[model samples]
Target chain A: MIATLLVVLQVVVATAITPLLIGVMRQVRARLEGRIGSGVLQPYRDVRKLLAKEPLRAEGSSIILVAAPLVLLVSSLLVVALVPLVTTANIPAVPNDLFVVVSILLIGTVALALLGLDAGTAFGGMGSSRHMMIAALVEPTVLMSVYALSIPVGSSTLSKIVVARGADVTRVVTPAGLLAVVALVVVVLAETGRLPVDNPSTHLELTMIHESMILESAGRDLAWLEVGSWLRLTALLGLVVNLALPWGLADSMQPLALLVAVVTLGVKLLVAGGVIAAAEVFMAKVRLFKVPELLAGSFVLAFLAVTASYLAG
Target chain B: MNPFRLLKLIARTGRIAEPAPAAPVADTEHPIPKALRGSVQVRHVDTGSCNGCEIEIGAAFGGVYDVERYGARLVASPRHADVLAVTGVVTHNMVEPLLRTVEATPRPRLVVAIGDCAHDCGLFAGAYGVAGPVSDFVDVDLEVPGCPPRPEAIVEALRRVTGR
Candidate 1:
């Protein structure tokens, strides 16, 4: 019974805090720019206002256009449910395996890109083309990074990776594991469309990728997209955080352990977000053609990680 | 990446000050906010202007002003807009399109005349091809009067509509 309760709590906490974490990054970016940013609760308010407003559909838009955001929202919810936020073993049905998690996410991305094409707008199609190019490169790197992290523990299960390393204070400091960390960081950055890859804040057509795809959607559809993006950000960051430093993840459902794990997970998620936001401030957006080289570089790191783990372990 | 270097740079140059608080909102002509409890999405229209109001509109979204903080944002389509923000004096050529855009917006729509030109045609009132104030077409819900109103005034108008 307690385990069931923790499972539900895990899902709710991760889902709810997703936007707050995004808000934190925005706030940090604003302060770094020496401006007074919106309050951390701004996402909450934005989502609330969006929910209250009526949605508008384009004249030629179809069921796909309408269903796209729903697909995005469902996948985001699935990801949060699958990711281990509190106890690593309380998952009731979703398998806690690396391959399963990555495959689920890939399906979600593919659906979103396909829906973009269904929007029937030229810009939407163009954004889909660009997004597909990036996703094609991102998938292999994400998988290889997972493989690298699992090498030392001799298991491919996501929870095992966490369980094996959670007690070790220095597992990630070694050369092979550090490569995994770097590779995953790059993958996460690319997946989330953060700076040096794609700028989330800009609407410049010549420079946009993700936001451009959803340009035709408005009102409630746009709101779902916005909230779904936040959930995706937190979900992916949660994976990276769990892999790189599984410290503080609870192995049992004791109330105190769950509480501590929840707090630790929140901190880890925010720190990762802050680091990404900081990277945004420190770097400029690379040109669109230059993105392949960036993804290629991450793939190289992922390759090296796999090579090193075998040689070093 | 050096924290000390960043601090040194910041200490040496204070952050850009907020654009002097928007020209004092002294006009009693600005409409009182309705009992709006939700956010507002604005679709900006430029019937005809010298580009002055657009510049200030940009400033209104810049870091310091951040109209988004008040639960209002600029969207790309009139279909998605809750408030149709018309700028400058409408040209005869623009009158039909302006009305159509406002009509395209969903119900519970609002009309905000963005500047003096939009308010009562401003300096362009007698210009050829001018269609006079936006009121000459659709009913305006709010009026922000300035050749180029400050970002704060624009934000204030939005706040009144959003009840922020």
Candidate 2:
């Protein structure tokens, strides 16, 4: 009963906080650029306003244009529920295996790429192709890095890995752990379309990888796409932080433990988001051709991490 | 530049945006839609301009003017926009594209005509290629009247829509 309740709480909390995370990141970027940003609550307003407007679809476009956003949103929510964020206590029926989690994320990624292609616009096709290329490179690194961490726990279930790491601090600070995390961070930036990989705020269609896909969608359709993408960032970033700092996660169903878990997760996510946004101020999006080089370099790091963990044990 | 130098420069530059002026009094003639009151995404359409209004529009969005602080953002697609910031006189060549762009935007949208050229064709009133003022081609909800309206004027017009 308590495990189910925790899963419910995880989904509800993650959904509520997703928009705030995007708002906070934008606020950080605006401040670093020496401008007073629209307040952190602005995303909530944008989403509400979008929901009130009529959605405009392109003539002759397939149902994928209408259905992809929901698919993406649902997949993101599933990932959030499966990942051990507020607690390491597992629900009996749901599998939180690393492979399962990665596959769920890919479902959303593919949905977005298809949404891009459904419109049949040049930019949409271009964006879809680029998005697929990046996803192709990003998935392996995500699997390998977690595989490296999984080696120490002798299990591929994410919640189990987190629980084991919380029990052993030495496992977290090892050379193998450090390399996997660095690789994970790079791939996370790439996966989430942050600066140095993709610029989330860019207006030029020529430079857009993510935005170009959804340019044909309007009103409520746009809102779903926006929120769905934001949720993916939230889920991935949440997983990254929990893996990096396994402390403060609730181990049981106690009320006090749940409260502490919620507070710590909020603080950790905000701090991580702000740090990433600030770091982005100093970096520019790499040219599309050079992106493979960056992703390849991270892959090498993950490969090294796996080798190191295997040899050390 | 190296990371160290960039860090020092950021610290030294500090805040460059001027203190924001008081919010504009709500325009009774053009009451903002309640839905768009807090946030408005603008898609700029250049019908045919001397490029003067384009530069000023750029300035309005730049760090110094920082119109985005009012929750008015420039978007890449009209489908993503709540307002069309139409600039310049409607030239013969641009009439169809402008109409298509406006048609592409979802309902509950506003068109804000920027510069005297967009309002009345300014000096381009009788030019060979000039079709008409923006209002002649589409319903202009707001007008910023200057040969090339100042950035502050452009910012003020957008603020009226965002109501922030």
Chain A alone, TM-score for each of the models? 0.95, 0.98
lDDT of 2 by residue, B30-95 (tens): 677888988999999999989999999999999999998999999999999999999889989999
The superposed Cα distance between candidate 2 and the true structure at residue B151, in angstroms, equals: 0.9
Error of 1 at A188 (Å): 1.0
Error of 2 at B53 (Å): 0.8
DockQ scores of the candidates? 0.35, 0.87
How much lDDT does each candidate structure score?
0.78, 0.91
Worst 10 residues of 1 chain A by lDDT: A85-94
Lowest lDDT 10-mer window, candidate 2 chain A? A86-95
Q: How high is the DockQ of candidate 1?
A: 0.35
Candidate 1 Cα errors over 4 Å, as ranges: A1-4, A90-92, B1-8, B14-39, B64-71, B75-81, B96-109
Ignoring the other chain, what TM-score does chain B have in each prediction?
A: 0.80, 0.98
In TM-score terms, which candidate is top? Answer: 2
Model 2 CA deviation exceeding 4 Å by range: none
Give the fraction of reference interface contacts each candidate recovers.
0.19, 0.85
Residues B1-164 of candidate 1 have per-residue lDDT tens digits of 58678767756765543643343343357543332234577888999988999999988877677766566777766755778888989999899999889877755678999999998888887888897889989999888989899888898888777665
Against the true structure, whose DockQ is highest? 2
For model 1, what is the alpha-carbon lDDT of residue A158?
A: 75
